[model samples]
Target chain A: MSDVSAHPSLSGYEVPIDSWTQPFWDATATRKLVLPRCADCDRFRWPPGPFCPGCHSQRVEWVPAGDGQIYSFTIITKGDGDQHQVFVPALIEFPEAGGLRLVAAIVETPLAAVRIGARVELSWSHAANATVPVFKIVTL
Target chain B: MKHESAIAGVGATPYYFRGQSAPQTLYEMICKAILAAVEDAGLTIRDVDGLAFYSMGFDSGLIAESLGIPELTFASTVSGTGGGSAGVLDLAAMAVETGRAKTVICVGACQQLQIRYGTAFSHMPVTPEKAWERAAGLTGPGQVFALIARRHMHTYGTRREAFAEVVISSRLYAATRESAIRRRPLSIDEYMAAPMLADPLCRLDFTLETDGAVAFVVTSGERARDLKRRPVYIAASAHGGTCEWGRAFHWLNMPDPIFTTAGSEPIAARLYAAAGIGPKEIDVALIYDHFSPLVIMQLEDYGFCHRGEGGAFVESGAIRINGSIPVNPHGGHLSEAYIIGMTHIREAVEQLRGEAVNQIEGAQFALVTGGPAPIPMSGAILRN
Candidate 1:
């Protein structure tokens, strides 16, 4: 486990929090990241869907997400220039969660230190009207 | 071993940057392109009895009403975002194959500057691309593909030079095409100097947004043979995604994912199988190069080479003129106008007709593909 960081420098974009996505976003407010798992298949789902994409079962449960690794990443250099934002966004994959990947902002990791398969843990930061999940490198 | 229908003629508005001197509105662009293809085929606009487009909201009835098309026996709009460019060709061919229509126009149009897809795409609300993803900084498709590129590099030791080769080859090809958007020769130094838009993807890695429309006329092979221009045979067409392979919609995340599919592999197999020819026969390729790395992936997925050999395969200069297969001789979307990948189809038709600006000697077959991933993609084979 690692300590959560503050909202990123350009992290104040208002995200549309709807009924379908409310549960996932709400978890971030408490500095937690929850993954919606197919209640029937036990497979973790992403982006919030009503049914299990695997079995088409109309059942899901948002459980506290498990640890994941840095599957891959990229440092987006071209921001619209308004956000004062330059950072590395990473795709974190859960080996336990059937290879499901969650895209999260990697904080406190230097660009040179970002490894393709490094372990990571979830952290959250409050940004305009929403709390978004960020990830911290799990250093031994 | 053949397509039941053939592309008799192809036409397009000149490629231009999205907002730079777009001479016509979207409707005007479509009408102009339709008329061009119609005239090229030695037929009147009135001859078109069916229409298909890759998801622009076109009122076929209104466009036809103006063109004096009495009735359209078939009109369809294929979906899949940018991946539908070649899919619409399949739909038009199907319409002509059936008794639904004798002549059909498959059109792809985009006014991205006026209708900034590059901007709106960052805010996409599709399934698995919810607000959380955007809020989490997974906004642009480049970033999504960037993740894929990184994984690919780690998986295969792919180098940035492989990407530069695709861009340079396409740009050099575009330099000869009068309508190509980015005619300026892109050098290795310039490509490397270009700022990274997304990590692993430089600004050049992304496709140019252009305001343009491309249209092609398709009809039965027997009818095509009678047309003025040499009919480019539609040897095969296929479209689908990797959902069955555990890929979530609009997201690259998948179980045991290779990140090489926008449903390209299976579709490529189906294409070669249906056409009764293997990859070696393809003389040129107008692969969808919305981003450069995917072009490498497409090469491999299409069985142009074995899995993981895309990096080296392209490095062999095989994708250049007279090498193995000239790719995007009119520059791809990267250098050419990104008319939503229709230019790729237009280029294929021109090549098969032996009219390509950088025509391959005795070229017979051409391959055209769509966006690399995140949805059901489309592709087709054309033969002279």
Candidate 2:
């Protein structure tokens, strides 16, 4: 059985962790964002795939995705008043990471101000022994 | 090119909330429907050689074993796409046409009433890339459709009242069917006053979660001719998909991105071409209504009307039972049990066979469509 009550604060929310995804959460604890990179094709991937989508090679390694540019985003004018009211879900793509994109919420910016192609950097927060990775606008 | 196969028989367990003392498991519901469908066609469970069902279904091995078949040849499980019903229709047609199987059974079952009530994502597989999207609290299927409803209203001046007409009309028809989950007649005023789930989208605009299963048996037309029940030929079927997850910034990147009129255009075009029939030839329709905006999108996509005119078309009450072409005469997902749109296909078969509880007179041709999710979509035209 899974530990349901241990994460009481996240009650009514899903706490997802799997064998392949544990390292990702570990990196987040140190406020770092990491993704699986294909050693053969030298491309980055999200969602911790066992093989590279670019070359379909099983030899892939996890690496840091230092920063990314927003490919697209939505302000989400309506939400259920949990994370929806405060978060701006954006699709961020890393140019140096071979167009690998991740869907993350942008912090420290008004929902209306979030736009496509916006520069952003990775940030992390701790929750129930797990670090949640998020994004914020890059300060130039 | 080979011709598509025919739907030999269709069946369903009584649709009810999961906790209604039904004493039924998901596998049991599937078995009941499969057995009933075989009986309806004057065939035996032993005749089934292959199966196609939703990936979300509870159990496949048990369903197969319960039927006590000697050997199984073909099996496919699908996820993603709200059009589970249309997917089965396509698969059934392919199964028979390819000689892969003599009789293929397609099934869909959901136990939403038994699952703990919180949100739909609770059951969804959460991957690292999807963490941020889920973390922002994007919850159920209705919520995703709600976003498109807002954009549709903003772009086409679609009034809330116009959207409510879909519910009001569907509920009015559903009331005639005793098996429908929501049979009470819904007036425009009551629809407007219903509790809101999403702004501009009221509770009435969403489908209810009920424990149920629907199944169909497909075979070659030559075989269907000798069956006990009327043979509803699978005239045409098609499917399409779009890459809109990363292109959401563009307002046009909403649910159905490929054909601009929603994915309905390609599916409908291919279906009509295969069947040698146009939208006007259809006598009944069962468009998937996970949300009401899709009804409007499908109306335009299926060539029932021009783009941007679906709001007016729905408001005209032309989709009612007595209208030119009755749509969702069984209340649809908005008022009927949400069975991943499989019930819609079952309803079409019933209409064609002249056996629906809320049967429309002389429904020789029926059109059914898939959902507006980012996944692959499908549509079918069934004729008696």
Per-prediction backbone clash count: 0, 0
Best by lDDT: 1
Regions of candidate 1 where Cα sits further than 4 Å from its true position: A1-12, A17-20, A78-84, B1-3, B123-129, B244-249, B260-262
Interface RMSD against the true structure, candidate 2: 6.2
Q: Fnat per model, in the order given?
A: 0.59, 0.13
Predictions in order: lDDT: 0.77, 0.71
Report the Cα RMSD per candidate.
3.2, 6.6
Expressed as tens digits, the lDDT of each residue in B98-217 for candidate 2 is: 888889888887765446322565566765545545654455555545555655665677788778888888888888887788888877888888766755567777777677888888
Model 2, which residues run further than 4 Å from truth?
A1-140, B79-81, B116-118, B244-262
- The CAPRI quality class of candidate 1 comes to medium
Q: Please compute DockQ, using alpha carbons, for every candidate against the native two-chain complex.
A: 0.51, 0.13
Candidate 1 residues B1-384, lDDT tens each? 333788988888876687764556777888889999999999997788899877444788788877788888889887657776788878888888777889998887777545566556554553424554565566667767888787888888888999999999988887877787788898899999998888789989888888887889999888889889888888898777656433332465655545644348877888898888888999888899888998988888888877788889888898998677778888888887888788889888888888878888888889898766445578898887
Q: What is the lDDT of candidate 1?
A: 0.77
In CAPRI terms, model 2 is classed as incorrect
What's model 2's overall lDDT? Answer: 0.71
lDDT of 1 by residue, A19-113 (tens): 66788777778787777888888877766776777798868788866879888878765445554456677778877766777877888765556
- Candidate 2 lDDT tens digits, A110-134: 5444555678876654454566666
